[model samples]
Target: MSDDPTGPPVSERTALRADCASCFGLCCVALTLTASADFAINKDAGTPCPNLAEDFRCGIHTRLRREGFSGCTVYDCFGAGQKVSQETYAGQDWRTSPDIARQMFRVFPVMRQLHELLWYLTEALTLPAAVSLHAELRASLDATERLTRLPAEDLAELDVSEHRDRVAALLLRAGELERAGVARRGKRSRRGADLIGARLTGADLRGAELRGAYLIAADLRGADLRRAELIGADFRDADLSDADLTGALFLTQAQLNAAKGNAATKLPDSLTRPSHWSADRLPTA
Candidate 1:
């Protein structure tokens, strides 16, 4: 993990490491890849990263920035990589046991995704503005943790996308509940918009125009938005953890922030704290 856990703690540096020194390069050997932004060569699932040296370190580690391997730089393991390498498989290298290595390799990605969700959900729960969604947050958190603890075979076969879709439904519902009873009036123009599942966390959107718009499950964490104009707009389960909006033009704090605000949540320049609010306001959702 990075020395500084502040800021958006979702970067690769914040992820856990597998301590490649003690184990074989199971991740590289078991996983396959095609030429993409993170890699330069086409490789199959069981192939190792070409940059992986025999010593289990990245061959291009010193020059990864210049070698078009920036993707590798951003990947975090959340400690699962090492867990798999040491605890689960007992430090067995892919070279020593290709079959087990393959299983580990396949499971690594699944665990990584779960960890990423945990990171986001945990961070989300820290926002005071999202108190209204506390039930939903806790539920999601439990679900995410369950997935993280799934058996390797089960995780490998899990349909993560389908799970994401299901969770999204709950988030959308939370958004609706939070924005209930707010009057929306304006020249509606955000019809048929595709803001669904967009990560607009902590965006500065004060006094813009968004009528009849679709913002379902948007990650509006820590956004600097205060009353611009929002009539007939959808904020289904959008995360607004630590957004600031003291004098937002038309938004109602009860309707907007009430849905999902945390203690770390920042408020607008002139708004007072909500009565049912918590002390841990998130920065912005």
Candidate 2:
């Protein structure tokens, strides 16, 4: 077993992860998709993807990428889809009533943001360096959890960004405390840095502050990213064939799913190797 102290109890953690079987395909209908490397067709907000089946399952789920719906595979709603479909709406679906559907769609995104914050706050609470902030983190997590249970109308009208901004500030302080020892060595902060397509193969990035870095298409093969603050980092198409990310902070499954990796890439115990990642191209670690 791993020694990473950066996750909630198994049940709570499972709730934070997506449960598509309990969802009503909210992501397919509530969000928009544009034609690009990620998607093969254009879809408007509130419009359901043509691939969504009558029972709220994807028609090409097992072959989304092969069918030009690669974007679908990377999206994670942090369990908001099921929360909206089952808890908030009490199992009501859009297909039966246009009004309920509209409200559900509007509330889906709001719930997603709240859930994302909960995920981060929960992780922060688990960090030993952030022990001083545990009380506040717990409070924030509770408040965010309550928001997720609000009625559909209230959720639709919620100013989720405001809450997100507040949580982001708290998370920043916690991250700073966790990375303080490394920061003393003059390691530069790379928050929101635009390093798109930059070559960083075999780089040592331990304890680096790379929050929100645009590492899209960056060559990061064999890089060391342990304890790196990677919240909001864009890793689209970045290579991670043999990268060690055992302790990467605030790294989400969606981010990993969007990037390229192989069997040799070491990941935190909290995260799983993405199914799309190359399983046989490299030897296992």
Candidate 3:
């Protein structure tokens, strides 16, 4: 259990993280893959990737990046895959029961979206500054959890975007309140900015609103990004070497995987350092 009064127990957060062993490789088959810098081949939704084994494990799990499927490495189902495969379908494999394949695939994305919201809501409850909204956040978390356990048919038909909008509003308010204490006048509100490849090395972006910002390939080495709102911020190829991201809002493991960071990149307690990063390597002059 968390010692902090405002924080949730560790189990609550762990329940929302992906457990691939309990999943049926839903992401390997159900989602579409476009041939880009991320994926090696173009695959339509519902078609199994050639690398998916009968046991639902990736054939090239260790060599995904080398095999040109780097995008697969960054995609997280947020525990939705296992929930759908194990609980929703009662541990049924799509290979054995092909009849449910289409519906199961349809429901996976919706459940993923819900789980993502649960992730953010869970984090929001941990923020001391968002204490006033904690009651509402808990309610939202409970309601969203109930939705995740709905029948497969109902899940496939769920209007997750509308629910997301409502949740987003509450999260927005929580972020504002949390940032208000640490954010300087000019550091707040960079929500959805086009900062792709911009030079921001050693920058002080504390408590900045960086939601949905195109920070692809941005130079963010040694930046002070503590308490910044990083939801949906593109970190693809962005250099986060030595960047302090402790307490950064809504920063996911997937985003860290997409970015270029070394061992010196400080992360939030909820997230881990991506294994692909160099071990304690320093930035070049």
- Candidate closest to the true structure, highest lDDT: 3
Better of 1 and 2 by lDDT: 2
Segments of candidate 1 deviating more than 4 angstroms: 1-27, 36-38, 77-79, 171-285
Please give the CA lDDT of all the candidate structures: 0.56, 0.87, 0.90
lDDT (Cα, tens digit) per residue for candidate 1, span 31-102: 666677556767787778877887788888667646875445444455567656665566676766767766
TM-score attained by model 1: 0.53
Better-scoring candidate (TM-score), 2 or 3:
3
* Tens digits of per-residue lDDT for model 3, 1-285: 334446672328787888999999999999999999899999999999999998999999999999999898899888889999999999998999999999999999999999999999989888889998887888788789889989999999998988899999999999988998993668757889999999999989999999999999999999989999999999999999999999999899999999988988899988989989879868733
| Candidate 2 lDDT score relative to the true structure | 0.87
Who wins the TM-score comparison? Answer: 3
Which of the two, 1 or 3, has more lDDT?
Answer: 3
Q: Which stretches of candidate 3 lie over 4 Å from their true place?
A: 1-11, 183-185
lDDT of 2 by residue, 138-165 (tens): 7788888989988888999999878888
TM-score for each predicted model, relative to the true structure: 0.53, 0.93, 0.96
RMSD of 3: 2.1
User: Where is model 1 poorest over a 10-residue stretch in terms of lDDT?
Assistant: 1-10
